[model samples]
Target chain A: MTQNLDLTDIQGNIVKAYGSSGFFKARYLFLRVDDGDKGRDFVGAITSKVTSANEKLKGDDALTVTTNMAFTYAGLQALELPTASLVGFPSDFVMGMSKRKDILGDDGPSDPKYWDKIWQEKVHIWISINGKTSDVVEERYQWILQQIKATGGVTLLRGHCGEDGNGNAVDDLPYQDASVLYEKDGVTPTAKEHFGYTDGIGDPVFDGQTNNAARVIGRGKLTRSGDWVPLATGEFILGHVDEAMEYPQTAPRPDLLSNNGTYMVYRKLHENVGTFNKFLDEQSKDYPGGKELLAAKFSGRWRDNGAPLVHTPDNESKAEWDKKFAAADDATQKRMLTDFTYNEDISGAKCPFSAHTRRINPRGSLEYGVKDAFHTPGALVDRRRILRRGLPYGKVKDETSDKGNHGIIFMALNADIKRQFEFVQQQWINYANDFKQGNDKEVLLGNHSSKDPGKVVLQVEPGSGKPPHFVNNIPRLVETRGGDYFFIPSIGALKLIAGGLVDPT
Target chain B: MSNIAGKAYAMNVITPIPWYKVWLNRLIFWAALKIPNVLNGLLTLSLIHYARWVIIPRDKFPRLDPSQPKEDLNYSYMLFFSNFNGSWDQYVDSFTFAIPSGLDLFWKMNVKYPKSVPLTPFHNYIQHNQIDTAHYYNAYPMAASNDVKSAKNVKKALIDFNAASSNKSPDEFLEDYNKLLNQLQNDFGEMRPTPIVSLAAQAVKERVMEEQRQSH
Candidate 1:
C-alpha cells in the first residue's frame, strides 16, 4: 500500500475492524463525567492504554485484547471542551443520535423511548474492549472498571445488556457483551447476523488503511476504467483528501486533535429473530422454490453459506458454488466471497432488486437496466461505504418468539456520519427510490411501523416464463435499541482533551 | 426534505464570486432577465413555484446595528433560491441532463463551479453551498406549481365556455360541453393533501402537519 497513514495516531478500530478480524468477544462500557478535571485525568490515563492503528498483527504479534475509546457530543462537553472546538464539529454529531432520530428513519417502535435506559440517558464516554475470547474480554472490562473506579471523576453508566442471555436486568449491568454467533455444534464461530445471513462482507478499503491491497476488487469504488483501486483516504479518515476532493470538515483549532481521526456510528440494533423466522416460514410456504430460495431472495445471499446470489442464481448452481468455495484456497475464497458484481444480473432476475444486500450495496447494479444513470458505475455507492464493526449481542433462547433480547451491537466507522452512515440508513435501507424499487424499505432493516410497511419484489428467473414473486407487507425485522454518533479521535486529540490544551486560536 | 411544502422543495444555495469575476455572472443574469426565453428549458420543466438569483456585493452587506461591525469580505455572494417540486437530486439531475449548458452558464462564474456533465462533483458543489431552510412557508401547502397553473387554466376555460355557449340549445350545449371536456382534460386533476408516496412525500406530509399544529 502506498501513502502509509500515521498509524500511531489513528484508532486501531479504523485500521482494522476488531469484530471481523478475530476479536469475537467484546464489551462496551459507557461513562459520565461530573467533574471536568477528573474527567481529563481519566482520559489521560486511558490515552496511554488506548490502541493505535499500527501495522497488522501477524502470528505471534497478534493482540489478545484491544482497547479503543470515543466520545459523544455530551461526552466532549462533559470533558469541558472549548466551545470553538465543540461548535466546529458537524451539526449531526452536535445533535447526537437521539435528536436526529427522525433523520435516521427511527420512529414508532424504533422510537427513542423504546431504546434502552442507558441510551435514554446522556452518555459521555464510550469504552470498547475487544478480545479473542470471553475471558480476555472480561479481563479488559474489569481493567477498565478499575480505571473508572480509580479516576473518581467519571461515573460508570450502567449498561443495558437487555438481550444478553444471562438474564441481566435492563439498565443495571456494568457493561454490554457482544459475541459472534456459534455454529450448531456451539464450538465454531460464524459471521452470520441474528437473521442468519452473512453480514459485513465488503467494507470499503481506503488508501493507507490496510496492507491487503489485493482486497480492493468489489470492496473499493468501481472505477470507470474498471480497476478496483482503494478509495481516497479522507473517506474514512480526517485531514486526508476525500472522494469529494476536499479535506473533511474537522474541528479547526489544534488541527492535530482532529487529524487522523474519524467518526463512528454506534447503534445497538436488536434483531427480532422470532418475527423474522415466522415471516420467512410463512412466506416460503407458497414461494415458487420454497424456503431456501425465498431466504436467498430476502437477502441476496444463500443463508447456509453466504454465497452471493449474484454468483449462484439457483439451487443447482448454489450447490456447485458451495463445493467451489469450500475447496478454494484462502486467498481465492476471500476473493470469491466479495468479488461478484451486479453486471451479470442487471434485471434482478437472479438477485431481487429489493434484496437487503443488493439495495444496501448495489455493487454498480444501478446501471443494469437504466444505462448512463450514473457518471461512473457505483459512484454514489462508493462515497457512502462504511467500515462495518460490532457483533451480535445476547443469546437466542426461543427461535419463535420476538422476546428475550437478542440483536447486534452495530458499529460503523466513517469520515462523515451524515454522508456515510446516515445516508445509507435513510436512503438505502429505509427508502427504495435509488434502487428503483419504488417505496419499498429494506426487508431486514427498514423502519416498517407506518400504515404502509414496504414490500419486496423478487424478480422471476429469466426464461422461466414465470412472473415476479411479490413479498408484501414486510414487518420491521430490526429495531434501534439505542445508540449515538461518536467521534473516535486520534491519540493526539485525547491528550489535548486530557490536558485541556484545546486552544481554538 | 424539511424545505418541502406540499410538492415543492425550496432550495437556497449561496456561492461566493470573486470580486474581479462578478461582472461575468452579472452579465449572464442580466441577459437572462432581459431575454426571458433564456430560461425556457427551466420553464418547460415546470418544477418550481418561484426561482430567483440575488447578487449581494461584498461591501454592500448590511450592518443592522451600530454594535455590528462592518463586513470586510473579499468576495461577493450569489444567492440562488428555487422552490422546485422534486427532490434535490431529481431537480439537479434533470437540470444536468436536460440543460447542462444552462446550468453551466448560471453557475460557471461562481468559485469552484464544476461543469454539470459529471454529476458527482456538481451534486457535491451545490450541496456544499446549499443552505437548508430552517423555516419555509407556502401560501398553498397542498398545491404544486402545476396544480396552480392547471386550476387557472380550468377556471379560464370554464368562464370562456359559459360566455360563448351558455344559452345554446340542449343538443348544441351537449356538443359544446363535449368539446370543452376534450380541450380541458389536461387540467382535470384535483389537488389534495400530498400523499406519502416517496421519502420526500412523507417528509412533506410531516412538515405540513407540523406547520398546521404550530399554527393552531
Candidate 2:
C-alpha cells in the first residue's frame, strides 16, 4: 500500500524466500571477519557477486545463483561500522544470543554453547549460497571460500554436506552439519522435514509478487461466501503499509539502510526422529483412527500427501484424496494447497485448535472467541505471518535407529522480529490459552521441555451425540538446536558497511 | 353471473395487499439494520456497528510507526513499556478500558491528545503486547534511562496483576488497576510512570488549580 518495492536495492532472499527457487541444494557459510579492512574488502567483493531481487535466471541450464548476507551486532562492530548505523536493528541482535537465551528457549542443543562454535566467537558475516545443482553450489562455495581466505576472513561454520578438499564423506565429518535434500516417493515430490510431514505449505503471499490469482483466492480470510483477499505487504516487507493501514516501524533512516530490508530469524531445529516415531507408534495403537489419522491430527495435514485434515478427516478417504490431489490441474492444485479456512470447522472437529499448523497461523479460527474479541475474522493473525524459507537438514535413517545429527535450518523472514517471529514462537508455539482450549501446547513443533512435560489435548467431535475423543500427553517432537536474530540489510546498506562509510551520529 | 364474477375479482385484489405489505415490512426492517444509512435510524445503527464491530474489536495498541521520527516517539514508548504488567488477557482487558478511559480523561482535561492516540485500544492487544515480551529478552532494547530496573518492575507488576485480576469481576479488576495505577504513580512519581497516567494526572491537577483560582 505504501509504494512499489525497490527490487534492485533489496536482497533476492528477502523478496522471494527461495521456496520456488528450484535450488534443491543450499549451503550456509558462517564467517568471522578477522580484520576490519580485509572484512570490508571481502564484503565489497561479495556484494558485487551477490544477486539482487531483480536478477533473472535464463533457463534450466543456467544455475540460479543467489547470495544474501546479514551481520550480527558484533559483526557490524567487527567491521568498524558506527553505532548510528545500527539504529533500527532489533535489540536481540545487539544483546546477542548469550543474553537473549531465556526468551528464545535456547537452553538445549539450541543452546548458545552448542551453536556452531564460530557463532560464539566474534563472528560477523553470514553468507548463504543456493543453486540448482550441488556441483554449481560447490563451485560457487569454493570460489567464495578462496576469496575469504585471501581476505584474511575465516569460515566459521559450514551447513549441508559436500566433500571437503580431502574427499572425506561430508556426512562422516562431525560439525554442525545440516542439509536441504529433497524427499521424493517415486514420482511424487514431497518437500518434508525430518518428521515426515510436508513442510512449507502455507507461506504468506505478499503484494506485487507473481501468483496473483493464487494469492487472491488463498491469502487472508475465507468468508462464508468463499471470497478472499491478500494480506497487507507491510506485514512482510519494510516501508510498506501494513493491514493496520500504517507504515511499520523501520530500522532507522528509512531511505538509506532500512528500506526493503527485513529481519530473518535463523534457527537450527533438530527433530528427534526416533523418539517421535516411537511415541506415534505406541500412541497410535490406542488411538481411535491409528497412526495416519494421529499424524494428520498432529500436523493438520495428511503425511503422505499434504492434504489438509479438514478436507479429508479419516484414513478411509486417504486413497481417494491422494488420487484427487495428484490428478488436479495447477490452479486446482494451488487452491487445494491453501484455499481452506477454519470457518466451517470452528469446533476443531476436523483440525484441532492446538494442531501445529492451526496454532502457528490460526487464519480465520482466531475469530471464534468472545463477542467482539477480534477486529475481523483473520485480523489477529495477519501481523504475525512470516515467510518461511527453511530447509530440512540431516538424512532420515531407519525409524528406530536414526541417530545421526539431522534437523532443519528453520529460517523465517519478517518485518518485525518481535511481532511476527517471537510472538508466534512464544505465545502460539510454546504457551497456550489464546486458543481457549486449555493449557495445552501445540501438539507438535511446540517448545515442549522435558522438565515441563508439555501436554497436548486433541478434541475430536464426531457429531453422533457420542463424547468427543481426547488424546493427551503428546511428547515433545522438535527442539531448538541453535538460532540467532539477524538484520538482512539492503544491498546498498551492505555496500555502505563494506566501505566503512556508516555515520554514527 | 357477470356481477358475481366482478365481485370475486375485487375480493382477490384486496386479499393480496396485506401479504405484499408483510414482505415489504420485513425487507424494510432488514435494510434498516444492514444497508448503512438507509434512514437516520440506519445511520445511528451503523455508527454503533462501526464502534462495536470495527474500532473496539480491532487491535489498537501503540505500534512503532515507520513514518514518525524515532527520537520524538521514544518517550511515550518508554512509558508504554513502563506501564505494562501481568498475563496477556489482563493486559488486554486493562488497555481495553485504560486506553478509552485515559483518552476520555484527556479530552475532559481539554488537552489535545495526539492523532496517534486511537491506535492504543487494539483488537489483538494480547498478541501486540506479547511482542513487547521481546523487550524482556532485550531484542529491541529501549534507550530510556533506568530501563533495566523499569523492566523488572513491569514484570513483577504483570505477575501481581495476573494474581489479582484472576476470577475478579469487572469492577474488581478496575479497582485493582486503579490501585496499580496509584502505586505506580507513587513509586515512580514523575520520573517513570507511563505517559498516559502522567498526562491524565497533570490534566486533572491543572483543572483543580483553575477551579480553585475561580472560587478565590
Candidate 3:
C-alpha cells in the first residue's frame, strides 16, 4: 500500500524547489557551533523559521522568503545529543566527507595545494536561503546570520554572488570564499550550469510527492502502457519502506525523531571550464561536424536548445526547432522536457553510452547483456535514483583561463547513500564493465584518475563504416573542492533536539 | 547347553576379516542346512553385510541439510564467498540456481566423507535457500528469470510485511493486510511468477573457466 507522506514534516527544499521560477537569488551559509546549549537554542529558534514541504511558492516574480537547513553528524554531536542515537546512520555520513575522500576518489585534487586549505575547515550546519530577488535574499541572509551568531555559532563559509553580466559566472572566483550563484540565462531563460547544458532535468519522482511531471517522461521500460508508478517514497525518506521492501537502517529514534528525515550529500565540485572549452575547440578540429556537434555528443544534448541528441541527431534549423515546440501543447511540452528513454537507442548509436546523462541515469538501457534483459530494463537503475537539488557555483570570468572555482554545488537526497548515490558515482560513472563497453569514464562529470588517465570512447554506430570516436588522455574536468554529508531532519525531530526531550530508550 | 559350539565360535571369531566367512560357515553347518537352506542363508548374510557396511554408515553421517530451518539447527553453518572482477549483477547471476565447480567439489565431499544427504536433495535445498537469500538482497530468484516484475513484487510484499508487522493490534494488522491486498490487485492487477529454464549450470561453467584463467 502506498503510504501517505506527511509533507508538513519534510523540509521544503527536499520535496520541491522553493524558488519555483528558477530566477530567485540564493545563498548557502555554512556554520560551526561553539556551544552545545546555545546550538540547541539556535535550533529551537529556527525550527519555526524553516520552511515545510507543504508550502510551495510559484510564479515568475513572486517574492517569498524560504529557508531550509541541514546538519552534519558533527553538528548533532556538538549539540550534546547521545552518541548511541547516531547509530545505524551510514558510515559515510558519520565519518563525514573528509574521511570518506578516498572512497569518493577525491584524495587528490587537480590543484592539490589549493584544496589543502579548503579541507582544513569543516561546516557543522548548512542553511540555505532563497528569495525571488537579490534584495529579499540579502534580507533573509542577514537575518539568518544574526540568528547563528546569537547561538554562539560562527559562519565557516559565506558565498553570495549572482550570474555574470552575460548571465554566466566569472572564471576566477576563489574555491573556498564564495558560493556560486545559479540563475537562468536572461536570453535563453533556461537554467544552465557552466557547461551550458539544460540543468535540473530528469529528477526522479517518488510516491506521495506532489511533483509528478517526471513520471510522464521519466518512466523507464519497467512501466507498461499508462500505468505510471512513482518510485517507493522510502527511496528518499527515512522510516519508510525502501525499494528493498524494508525500512533502511536509520538513526535511533522514537518514530518522530527519524521519520520524514533524509540524508543529503552536499558536494562542492569545482569545474575546469577553460580546459573543457579548449579541449572541445582542439578535439573537434578533425571531426565531421566540428565543436558544437562534439559538445552535443559529450553531453547527449545540444547546448543551445537542450534538444536530446537521440531525438534530433543533427542540429535542426531554428524554424524546424520552433515548429517542434509550437506543435506540442503545454502539458506535452512539459512532459517532453524529460520524457525520452534509451529503449530505442539500445546500441547507443544516437547517444553514446559514455555520455554524462546516459552514464548517470541509463534509463532503460542498462538491461542489455544482463540476465532477464527483456523482463525489466529499468531494474538495474531503479535502486540507484537520487533526488537531485543542485545549482552551479562560481562564475566563469575568462573562458580561456583554467584557473577558476566555477562549478556545481552538487546536492542530492537519498535514503541509502551507499546504494543510491555512491553506487552511481563508483560503478556506473567511473567503472566501464557494467556498460559492456571497454574501460571508459563519463565524458563530462567522471573523475579521470591521474594514475590511469582513463579514455572516453564514443561508439558512433555502423553503416558509415567509420571508426569510433576516441579521445585519449582525458583530464579530470571536475574537482571536489570540499563536501560533507548532512542529515536533514523533520521539523518534529528538530523540535526534539532543540527541547532536549529526546528519549534515548 | 552349547559349550562346545560356543568355544568353536569364539575361536573362529578371533580371526580378522576372514572371521566373517568362518562364522557364516559355522552357522550354516550348525543349522544342518540343505542346499536350498544354505543358498537362502548366504543371501540373507550378504544383505545384512551390505546394510551394516554401507547404508547404516551412510545414514549415520549425513551431509549438511540445507532444508533445516534456521531456528532448528544448533551449530551447522557454511559460508560461501567469491570475488568477481566484473559486473556485480552478472557475477551474482552466474551462481544462481547452480553450484560452481569449486562449490560442487565441496558438495561432493560428502561422497567420500559421507556427511550430508544425497546430491539431488542437497542441490534442491540449496536452490530453495538461494531464492530466500536473493529476496533478502532484493534480487529475483533464478526460477523467476523470465519474470522481471517478480523482484519489484517481492519488494512490495516485503513492504507490506513490514507494515503489518509494525501494527500494534490484530485489527490494525488485518486492516493493513487488507489494504496491501487491495493495493497489489489495483497496482499490478494480477501477478504471477513466470518460470524460466535454468541456465545455472552454464553460468557456473563460465565462472569456472574465468576463475581458471585468473589463477594462471
TM-score of chain A of 2: 0.90
RMSD of each candidate relative to the true structure: 9.4, 18.5, 21.2
Per-residue accuracy of model 1 over A1-505 as CA lDDT, tens digit each: 6667888988898888786778889989888898999999999988888988883544578888888899998889989888877888988888899877766878888898888888866799999988889898888877877878898899888758563345654656767788999999998999988888887877788888667866887888777666788888988889888765667764445587788888988998988899899889988888877798889888888888778888888888888999999999988888887887887787677887767788768776555544444456665577778888878888888899888778999889888887678877876676554454434677888887647655666775544434466687788889888899899999989999999888777
- The residue-by-residue lDDT of candidate 2 on B30-105, one tens digit each, is 6545754333321211101111110111123244886754342211110121222212323333233223333232
Top-scoring candidate (DockQ): 1
What is the TM-score of each predicted model, taking all chains together? Answer: 0.78, 0.70, 0.68
Tens-digit lDDT track of model 2 for A138-183: 7888778778777765555544333455544353221333345554
lDDT of 3 by residue, A1-505 (tens): 2557887889888887543445345667677778788888888877878988877477554338777778898888887777667674667788886665434556457332345343455567888877666677778777766776776544455332234446653333222223324444443333677877776666777777755444535642245342446777878898887654557665456667788999999877778888788878878987776688788888887786566767766556433655777798877666655677776576666777778778888775654523332224464566788888876656687888766457777889998776678767765676544464433667787777567565665665544434456666677778877677899999889999888777668
> How accurately is candidate 2 docked according to DockQ?
0.02
What candidate 3 gets wrong by more than 4 Å, as runs, is: A1-3, A59-63, A110-113, A116-118, A153-189, A211-215, A219-221, A224-228, A316-322, A369-375, A449-452, B1-82, B86-216
Ranking by TM-score: 1, 2, 3
lDDT per residue (tens digit) for residues B1-216 in model 3: 110110010000011112223344344334434434322321211101111111112113254696744343222222232212222222222222111332332323222222122233433444333311221221322211112233466577767679656755887776665545433321221112111111243345458789999999
| Predicted complexes: DockQ each | 0.05, 0.02, 0.02
The TM-score of the first chain in every model comes to 0.96, 0.90, 0.89
